[model samples]
Target: MTAMPEWMSPPRAEGWYAEDLDHLPEAPRHTELIDGALVFMTSPQRWWHGEVVTALTIALRQQAPEGWLVGREMTIRLDKRNRPEPDLLVTTTAYDPDRTWFAPEDVQLVVEVVSPESAHRDTTVKLRKYADAGIPHYWCIEDQAGAPVVHVYELDVPTGAYAPAGIFREVMKRPVPFEIELDLSTLTP
Candidate 1:
């Protein structure tokens, strides 16, 4: 029988905390904490996913107002036990080379480029979680027939839930989360 590695063992009876992710050097890149458990991105990312994420990051950064930052593959520490990494995020926090994660309050918008394995979590679990944490905006991008389709949502502060803002196919333009327009077709080959 095979034995599990020490780092794979839960460090506490209650399960993994958000801060524990930083201490585990053996953990895989893009490991996420949800409901006190670790979720690893073990599948090879498709080229479509890579291109879309990269292109979106560049587009967002180009239009971002001063003092705002666009980053990719960074986790958001929503609370003690939940830290999910969005594919991209726009933040008010200035550049910090040593930073590993952002607090929910600092995040202005989170974009998840949905892959097959992450579809359920991104569209449902994360949609609820981000809204519950008062993230203000969320964008879930799905590849439709080789083109990027963005589904945007805004936090309904009164209900602590997300309201559908808009969905864009060829182009995405929004005033909140800063005024910006993206030609979605350009995100991939």
Candidate 2:
């Protein structure tokens, strides 16, 4: 007998669900696959949260190196068991639809714009997952205390975890190939 694929099985828990990915339905908003779990993305209010994400996206794009692809809400297939749509993803190159999975080799940086509802996951769940996957860089952008701030982490591959790279109230120049342009002052209302 043939083994059944995991996605064919019934969902196992709350806060996540498995998706065929190839045949997945288009979400009304945004969604991600995490540990074979379908994680829904909530729409942000028309305020600081939304504005910050927009600013980062534009800045990263402008600054990114020629071969690097800075994507917003892109569906990255991290592993067969996990897929998460980070707020901003700095990949080595543009995506090829023909591919089936995303490995650490394909990624250079992963950024998460934190919301109150997802504070825990951004710092814990997703952080660990990204680290274990060998993603080299991670950024957690938070807007809870009026001004947006960024916490950066650099992965230690052999250990499969992250170490503090820096914490900044302003956008710092990324050392990679990209050249991002962000004027934080104009990034809000």
Candidate 3:
């Protein structure tokens, strides 16, 4: 009998570390590996979240410095056993075009447009993970309110917590260097 390569091994029902993801024959829709566990996402309840994401992307493009990438729906490898697809990500242009996904090291900012089902996970689980991985920025957009609200978190290296940047008013863009000048109302549903 021949031994199979690690990637070819059968996947465990839960607790999916990064190594296990390498063997996934193909990308499974709406699944992210968190702390070695497979977390599935429900489809968006409405298109408002997506529209906000698009607005943010466009705003970033207009204001971000050269050599920075404002990307949407990119899979970032946060650790050996975890990957989460954020709605938006900003990073320096050093990304590897040949690689199938961006590793944690390649990430600079991660943004999540919260769905009704995703609010808890986004604020707690995902927030902690991003902080642990030392990701510089994390943004959570909540549209449940009549007007969309965005929560910005910046990593504090020594303490490792994602502290809020501030309460942004009508227009909330990504901070300078990343280009954050947009009318917040446009992003609201």
Instruction: Give RMSD to native, each candidate.
Output: 0.8, 5.9, 5.1
Model 2: how far is 1 from its true place, Å? Answer: 39
Model 3 regions lying over 4 Å from their true place: 1-14, 22-27, 173-179
Q: State in Å the error of residue 42, model 3.
A: 2.4
lDDT of 3 by residue, 110-172 (tens): 889888778788889889988888888888878745566778888888898888886566767
| Model 1 / residue 15 / CA error / Å | 0.7
Candidate order (lDDT): 1, 3, 2
Report, for every candidate in turn, its global Cα lDDT versus the true structure.
0.94, 0.70, 0.74
lDDT of 1 by residue, 21-136 (tens): 99999998999999899999878999999999999899998999999999999999999999999999999998999999999999999999999999999999999999999999
In the predicted model 1, the residue pairs found to clash are none
Q: TM-score of each candidate?
A: 0.98, 0.78, 0.82
Candidate 3 lDDT (Cα, whole model)?
0.74
Top model by TM-score, which number?
1
**What is the lDDT for 73 in model 3?**
76
